[model samples]
Target: MSNTSNFRDAFRQAKTQALVGPNVIANALPYVGGGLVLTALGSYGGLGVLRTNPELFLPTFFGAIVLQLILFFVSQNVAEKGNNKVALPLLATYSLLTGYTLSGLIFVALKNQGVGIQGIGLAALGCGVTFIAARQIGSNLSEQDGMALTKTINLGVIALVAVLVVQLLFSAFGVYTPNWLEIAISGLGVFLFVGASVVDFYILPRTYKDDQYLPAALSMYLTYINLFVFILRLLIALNGRD
Candidate 1:
């Protein structure tokens, strides 16, 4: 009788220790929302500064990029090591820096092309649709499907890097890219980033422990920002010839 009781107690403990998907999602939402709010504020502030002092544009843009990259790697390291205290702040800082960099592009789009509102609206729409799709796709994932998705994500990253490298080469050589090529690249960016967002969302519940919510949220936040930026650029590029 005692042996049976012990076995039951051990099984109960193991069950209690298992990670709960809903609980992880619930814990992550607040951090993701907070990151978005910070990004919005940073973007607004950056736009104002750039508008007031156009001469500072290059410095501000490059500085934000550098800072964001640093914070991103550091945050990833901290998060992977399960240091929530350090990781959360680092992630927040990275988001704000990214917003600042994006604001420079936004300001130019608004002033030169007058497509700011359209870009914002489209970005919001893209985010909403991506979130819904991610949830639907993520919830239905089995272990086998998750493995396949992992491979897809890896391939997606490689493709994204190749695209970026080609764009940089064109820029470095001062080659005049055709309008159609620019539009195509922008469209590709939108698709790639949205796909990344979906993958992140789908894998979050499957991989992360409840205590690892900070990192999970950080991953989603990065995807959200990337998706918005890609959509914004696509919209602006499309409107340029109009």
Candidate 2:
């Protein structure tokens, strides 16, 4: 009788954890959505400000980056300690700062070519496709599959960083890339970031602990932001081509 009772208790505990795990991603959706709205507002707001005080753009852009880095590291530290109280606030602030920086880029693009609406539309479409793919992939992720995806994502990120570094070095040497190469790089960036968002969303529920929802949300938010930036860039590149 005692053996049966222990087995039942263990099963209940396992079931509870399993149930709680998926809610992490579900709960994160609202935060990610909120961040997106904030991004749009910040972009518009930054553009408005830039019209009057263009000199502030560089300082504001770099300031947002520094602030975001600080908030991100602090949020991660608190989340690691399971302190949602501190982590949630930090995450919110970080999201806003990220939006501010993104807004600066949008402002630049708008000033250059007035492609704001089209750029946003393209980003939305990319996000929609990425979300659908992620949902399909996440629904069927076993533990082994999740681990394999994680490894692939890590490798992909490393390769992407290396490629970017090479490009930057070439630029430093005043080496000009062909137009085709620029377009290809822009397209590849969009593809990579979209794939990253899918992987992040797919593994989020399986990977994060119960109290680590903030960190999970942060990861997803960053993925989405990167996806938006890359998609927007790809759109602009194609527009320029035409």
Candidate 3:
């Protein structure tokens, strides 16, 4: 029984590595394509749309989350087939669509501030830098430390959800005031999500190798998107009027 269990573990790891190569390709293409298209739209067409209907922004926000969930389930189902070639393309397409949906951020920022997009840039920079740092630190941690980091990441998600719930409640009540409390909550959220991103990156290449490519790509994709949104909200919380 011990030998059998060991063999299964070895097989799973090998499968995950096989998927990694194709997953990386599928993952990169969507980001590049969707990014270019959205950048153009936001830099040009997005402005007019937001001006005409500000409500559209709500759909973009909600839609991204919904689509993200859908893709997650789909990826899981694809993983069961033991063939990543087809799954890679689906993941890439999902990434592009997600990019298109997120373009609304550009319109929202421009409408708030007159042609300035510093908030968006800052958000991106914060996420990128934090992700890089977390990855390096995660790589260096001892096995025991790594396990502790995993616990931290999980707890961070719970804390993040709690914060989101409170924020939503405040917003719904029409008293969404920005205070030190809110600032602290948002700051903690940023840290948690950044930590989660690093943990996800670390786990992807090793544990989920069965459809390693899709899972890894999906993990990072989710991380980047969450990081971006969190940074944007942090900017709004810090700088926007109450």
Top-scoring candidate (lDDT): 1
Segments of candidate 3 deviating more than 4 angstroms: 1-48, 51-68, 80-83, 100-105, 173-179
Tens-digit lDDT string for candidate 3 (10-120) = 234433322244244344435434443443443354345456766775676576558755765675468445557766656655655555555565555544562238887
How does model 1 score by TM-score? Answer: 0.84
- lDDT on C-alpha atoms for all candidate structures: 0.69, 0.66, 0.56
Candidate 1: tens digits of C-alpha lDDT, residues 1-242: 01112122222333332234556766888998898888888888898888798788788788888887778767866886799988988888877887787787677567645476776876878898888888778666665665566557556655766776787798889975677887787787677666666566555655567787876777777767777876777777777744
Candidate 2, 1-242: lDDT as tens digits = 01112122222333222434667777777877876777677777667767888888879888877887777677766875778887777777776677677776676466546365766776778788888887787666775665566556555655666776788799889985666676777777776666666566555655565556766666777777777777776666666632
Of 1 and 2, the candidate ahead on lDDT is 1
Ranking by lDDT: 1, 2, 3
Query: In model 2, where do residues sit more than 4 Å from their true spots?
Result: 1-20, 111-114, 142-144, 166-178
Clashing pairs in 3: 16-209, 16-210, 19-213
Predicted structure with the largest TM-score when compared to the true one? 1
Descending-TM-score candidate ranking: 1, 2, 3
lDDT at 21 for candidate 2? 64
- What's each prediction's TM-score? 0.84, 0.80, 0.69
